[model samples]
Target: MRLSHKLLRDAALFLILISMPVYYLAFTYSLKESSKSRELIVTRQLTSFQNTLKEALWNGDSPYTRQIVSTLGNIEGVSSVVLYDDKMEKIQESNSPSKRIPFSHDMYKELESNQVKQIKTKSEGSFLVSLITKKTDQGLEKLGIIKIDIHYNDLIKSAHARSRTMLAVLLGIFILIFFIQFLYLREFLIKPLSDFEKAISEMNVYADIKLKEDPNHVFEIANLTKTFNHMGEELKNSAGIINQQQMQMINVSKMSALGEMASGVAHEINNPLMITTGFLERIQKAVQNDPEKYSEIAMHTEKALKGTQRVAKIVKGLRSFARNGSKDPMQEVETEKIISETLELCFERFKYGEIQLEITKTVSGKIICRESQISQVLLNLLNNAYDAVTEMPSKNKWVKVEVADSADQNKILIYITDCGPGIPKDIASKILEPFFTTKETGKGTGLGLSISVGIVEEHGGKLYLDHGHDNTRFVLELPRA
Candidate 1:
């Protein structure tokens, strides 16, 4: 799931995998130690038996030999006892129908060599026995081997049971410790980290910085959380500062554009004002003439008034278009009407520059957008296309605007295609970014595409450059109303 949890789980599994072999090794070592202890005990018991037999043999009595055998046989974990001579002949053997003694030449050789020997044999069950002899003080030279056989199966069974019990206890302890640590980690680490992660993920870069505090967490996690919170605060503050700077830049750019358009707006207003003033003077002159001519003069004056009004409207539109602000409210506007109006506004520039415009309206539906804003968007695209085509030396230079309905019939798609050197693949993605323009200084404000993008997004639409085709196509897809 999460990185920390995965790491913790992997660590736990690794510990278990690593501990298994160690546990087995410990069990094997414990069994070996137990076997060695059993061997030592058997050796000591056989040594004592040998001493008893030596004492009996030095007494020079056969009855004492039988007595020694009787006493040795009564020893627990001892199956049978045998007394052997120096000639390798059994001198006295404690005969029991239920018990069998395993005596071999190796046993006698070991006794003569004064070495303790343990031999295991499989009969009714696995058996381990030791053989040895001791010297007598009477010099009778009693070369008697004391034999003690033990059930190897019983010893092994006991060892296995003890090992299993030990392993079970060790495992229980390990589990308990692991769970306790897990609880501690969860309480002091995991919960705090989770809270910190959630806070960081929900943090807004544009909004005020807010840090969540976790006093219950461990020192390391709390410190990390504090560090991340500080980073988020710094980022938020920086973003706000950058946003203010950008707003100021946009305002400055808008002022510059308005300054440049001031002369054109003045000319527009002067022409209308002059016409209106002239029409009023004419009306005054006609009023003094024939009464019939007064009616015609009034109509002509009305026509002049309409012309003046149209010029005033154009100036107002220009002023509004150059203003920089947040997007206007969306409305249902005809795509073809917006395109035509934008072209009409820029018709003078195109005529003066001798740029050809090919406008194609394939769809005649209403698109959800602001009419003035969408007109500005189209104007920007057309203007950019005009500049691009004029810069190229191609004989067939034209800017084409095509409008069509989306395949789903739920949206309208506008494509502005230019027959000029297409934009390079490297810089395509940066084209819509604010202040990113390839135009020469003083020729562009670089806010056209960026503002256009904002307008498109405000209308719940998308504006993108389509470079897959041969021509540079700026596509605008707006939802249908």
Candidate 2:
């Protein structure tokens, strides 16, 4: 059965079970009370009958006595009202109300005591028999006795009828209460829960979206909905962060692969470049004695050597940078060494762009870090600086690198600043966010700052923009060895 029907059924059964004993007790008490009422009424009537007899019999008027007896017999629950003397002589009689009372007349004990009583006598049948004794101021006068047949059985039957009626009323009230409870639970409790379940069943597992709120919900349901919606929002935000982290990892993987290829290619080209440089050196030395025919050849050879050496320097920078140094040993390297080696990877860009580069060493110390990773950080910053001022005129373009110790003397600080317009206040905070960039399309991937931030943090350092600077400046702080 559905929950509504089952709840109602259980409630009804509980009511019936709980009410039966109460009904029985009520019925039993009612019957007892009815019997008491009947007795009291009968007692009062007997007293009145005796008082009437004392008046009538005192006058000794036989017609008046008969008239009182007839009037008494007409009262409710009284079958017959008859009078007799102590010598067993019948004086007056009334017709029986329903049935005749075939009772012995000798038992007039209740009338002797002036209270109501039912006397059992041996006769042809059985019935309620009452008696009364009349008295006067003269003495204990047995003026007359009444034989009243009170209908005890009828009184009991009436009590049973009334008790049954009351039990029926109580049962109806219980049913009505159960029915009302069922409707309330179905509308406010059961149906709302079922609707919530259906909404959940239709929701997508991968999506983090809010469930619609029901304005009519109770506190418990409303609280549940609020918690669910809050959880969905939290999950949605967490998913975005997780996806960014995943993309960062993928990009790092690609860079590591490219680094490995660069390492391999540099190794293959190193021997040929060295051999060619040696041959060109010997040719220049051998042709130096002849000025006329060998001058152009020597000049061309010098140019060839210069270009070849530059290629060699670039190849060496590529090899050094291409090292996957995440697990490399941390060491204390001179501040000058780190800067000079990192510039080798991007020095050509500065020269090609005619961007004046300035280097300042306010404080000198060995920094504790993985050399290759630190070089990567410096290279990224240098490249960004180069790109920043690359669009400006030669005279207007400049980049500065400064090395110093932090105020606490516990960290090494490297500041790279460019003459390009500084990052806007609005976009500055978002620069470190993955895939968020200010550069035009194709010029930047936007992962550089985010990945650099991660790298510096792994090395127990920080990389952040220095808002105090007038131009675009980045501060990289690493622990001092």
Q: What TM-score does prediction 2 earn? A: 0.67
- Model 2 ranges off by over 4 Å: 1-35, 51-62, 76-96, 99-115, 118-128, 132-248, 347-365, 383-399, 404-412, 419-421, 424-447, 457-461, 479-481
Model 2 C-alpha lDDT per residue in residues 1-481, reported as the tens digit of each score: 7787788678878877977676677767876676556656766766666666767777788888888878777766666776776565788878844566665544564344454456533322233443444445876656556666655566567666777788888888878987787778787789877876775776554575566678887788888878877877777678777877787777778788999999989988998999999999999888889888598998899899999988888788788789888889888888778787778667777888888777865577898888888898888888888877887765868898999889999998999999986788989889898788777877687888887998899889999999998889999999888
Question: Each prediction's Cα RMSD?
Answer: 16.0, 6.7
Instruction: Tell me how candidate 1 scores on lDDT.
Output: 0.70
Q: Ten consecutive residues with minimal summed lDDT in candidate 1?
A: 123-132
* Model 2 steric clash total: 2
Best by TM-score: 2
